[model samples]
Target: MMHRQRGVGLVEVLVAVLLLSVAVLGFSALQIRAVSATDESLVRTKSMTLVRNLSEVMRAYPEAYVTVSGTTFVTAAASDAGAVPTIQAVISGSATNTVKVDSDDISITGTDSCLSTGIKTVDDKKVAKQACSINQLAARDALMVKKIATDEDIKVNVTTCPGTTTQAIQTQMCVITAWNSTKAILDDDDEKACADSNGIYKSGSQCLISEAY
Candidate 1:
C-alpha cells in the first residue's frame, strides 16, 4: 500500500515538466544571442580588412592618388598649422568588377589652419586652397589608372584680400578655388561612388576632402 502512494504525483510531474521547459527556453535564447553577436563581429572584421587592404595598395603607390566614381584617395600635404593630414580610400562591390573593388573613393586633407597660433583673421581661404590642390592631385592619379583625362579645363581660383598682410598682422583673408573632378562628378550625378574608404572625411557614406583655410 505505501509503495502505491510513492509511485508518482501529478503535481510533481507537472512542476518537473515546467522546469525543463524553462531551461530549454533559456538555452534557446542564449544560442540566438550568441549567433547575433557573431554576425555583427563578422561584419566589423570584414570592414576592417577592406580598409587595411586599401591602405596597403595606396602605400605601394605613394605618389599616386586614385578615385573611382565619387571617391578620391590621395596623400595630404603638411602645413605649418600643426594639423594632421588625412588620406582615405573606399571600395564597393560590383558584379561587373568583382576583383576590381569597383566603387572606390579617396581623399586627402592638408593641415588645419585653425591652430592656436595660426592665421587669425582668415584661415578658411588657405584651407580651401589646400583642399583644391589635394583634389587635383587625386584626379591626376585616378586618370593614370583609367583612360580619363583630368586636365581638360582645369581651373584654380582664389579669393584673397586686395592687399596681402604679413603673418604678424593676421589681417589676410582669402579662399582657394580649384577644379574638383571627383566632386564635380558626384555633384552632377547627385550620387556618391565611394561609399567606403579610409580617412576622416566621411559624410553619410561619402568621402569629403575639406580643410580650414
Candidate 2:
C-alpha cells in the first residue's frame, strides 16, 4: 500500500509566514517608539543642563551687579578668569545727571557737582586773619562755578578755586518721583517653559504571554 506523503500544506505555510510578518512588524514599531522616546529625553536633559550652567554663572556675581530696568535684570556673559564667572553692573537710570520720564509714569532727576566748600586754615593766626577773607573768598568761588543742564530737567553745577592751597569736593544726587495718577509698568511673567515634550513607552509583546499547548 502506498502511504500518502505528509507535509505542511501551502495554506499552512502561508499562514505561518503571515504570522511571522505581523510579529516582525510589531517589534519594529516598538523599536521605533523606544528610539523616539530616548531622543526626546536626551534633548530635555541637555536643555536643563544649559539652564543650570547659566544659573551657576549668575550666582557667582554680587547682588549689586543686578539692575532692574523694566522689571528685568539684564544679564551678560561673565568675564572672570576664575572658576566662578562675573557679570558687569549696568546703570539702569538715566545718565549721571540726567532726568528721565519712564514708561512706568515715574520721573527721575539727578544732580552732580564737582566742587564743594570747606575751610582749612594753615594756623590759628591765619584762621583769625582769614576768617573774614575766607567768607569773601567762598562767596567769590561760588559765583565763579559753571552750571550746566545735563538733561531736559536735570542740572549740574560745578565750582572751582585755585588759591595758595588746594581743596577738593564732589557731590551727586538723584531723585525719583512717581506720577501719582498713573500706574507703573509691571512684569508678572518671568519664567521659562519646558523645552520639549515628555517621552513615553508602551507595552509590547514582552508584556503578553504565549498560548499553552
Candidate 3:
C-alpha cells in the first residue's frame, strides 16, 4: 500500500508540472501579442494626429485650397447599384446627379520655392522668412511622412488629392490637406490603407487620407 501511494504521488506531481508549463507558455504568448497590439495602436494615433495637423496647416493657406462659390457638394445616388446597402440610408433623393461644389484637388507637386521679394508665401500668408510654396509644401509633407513611415520599414506616398479614378465633382471643394502613412503600417497592401489606388504600398507603407478637414 505504501509503494502504491508513492507512485500515485509521483504521477500527480508530473501532471502539476505539465499544467504549469502550459500556463507559462500561454502567458508569454499573451504578453507578446499585447505588446504588438500596443505598438500598432501608437502608430495609428500618431498618424491620425499628423493627418489633422496637416489639414489645419493647409487651412491656414486659403489660396492653396480656396473653394469657389456656387459649387455643388459630393453626393451618392440612392438607386445606384454600387451604393452600399448598409450605409445607403443616409443618401437622400437618389437617381439624380449628386453635386460636390467647391471641391478642388491639389494640382501641383514640386519643391519650387514660392517666395517673392524676400517674403515667403507660407500657410496662406506672405512672411519675411524662408518658406515653401503650396506645391513645395505638399511635396515636403509627403517626404516627411515617408521618412517617418520608412523608419519602421513602411512606405508612404502623397499624391495629388482627388483620386484619379473617380470623376470630378462640379460643386464646392473639400480641402484634403494630407495623407498619413499609417494605413499600410502593417505592410499590408489593402486598398483602404490609402484613398488613392494609384499609390498602393507594399509592406509597412501606411496610407493616410484626409477625407475632410
Q: What is the TM-score of each candidate against the true structure?
A: 0.33, 0.29, 0.45
TM-score of 3: 0.45
lDDT of 1 by residue, 125-147 (tens): 43322223433443323233221
Highest lDDT against the true fold, candidate: 3
Q: Sort the predicted structures by lDDT, highest score first.
A: 3, 1, 2
> What's the CA error at residue 11 for candidate 1, in Å?
2.2
Point out the higher-scoring one by TM-score: 1 or 2: 1
Writing each residue's lDDT as its tens digit, candidate 3 over 1-213 gives 786677887899999999999999999999999998887777666666655544454444333321212222222342343321111111111211121222322112322333324776789987866544443343234334434444544333222334443312221112221234334222234444533344344444334444432
RMSD of 3: 13.6
lDDT of each: 0.32, 0.26, 0.39
lDDT score of residue 65 within candidate 1: 28
The sequence of per-residue lDDT tens digits that candidate 2 reaches over residues 1-213 is: 134544547678999999999999999999999998886566445434433432333233222122224322322222322111111111222233221111111112212222224345675433332232222222222222111112222111111111212111211111111111211111123111111111111212111011110
> What is the overall TM-score of model 1 with all chains considered together?
0.33
Q: Return whichever of 1 and 2 wins on lDDT.
A: 1
Name the runs in model 2 displaced over 4 angstroms.
1-8, 64-213
Candidate 1's C-alpha runs over 4 A off are: 1-8, 65-213
Two-way lDDT contest, 1 vs 3, winner: 3
Q: What is the lDDT for 72 in model 3? A: 24
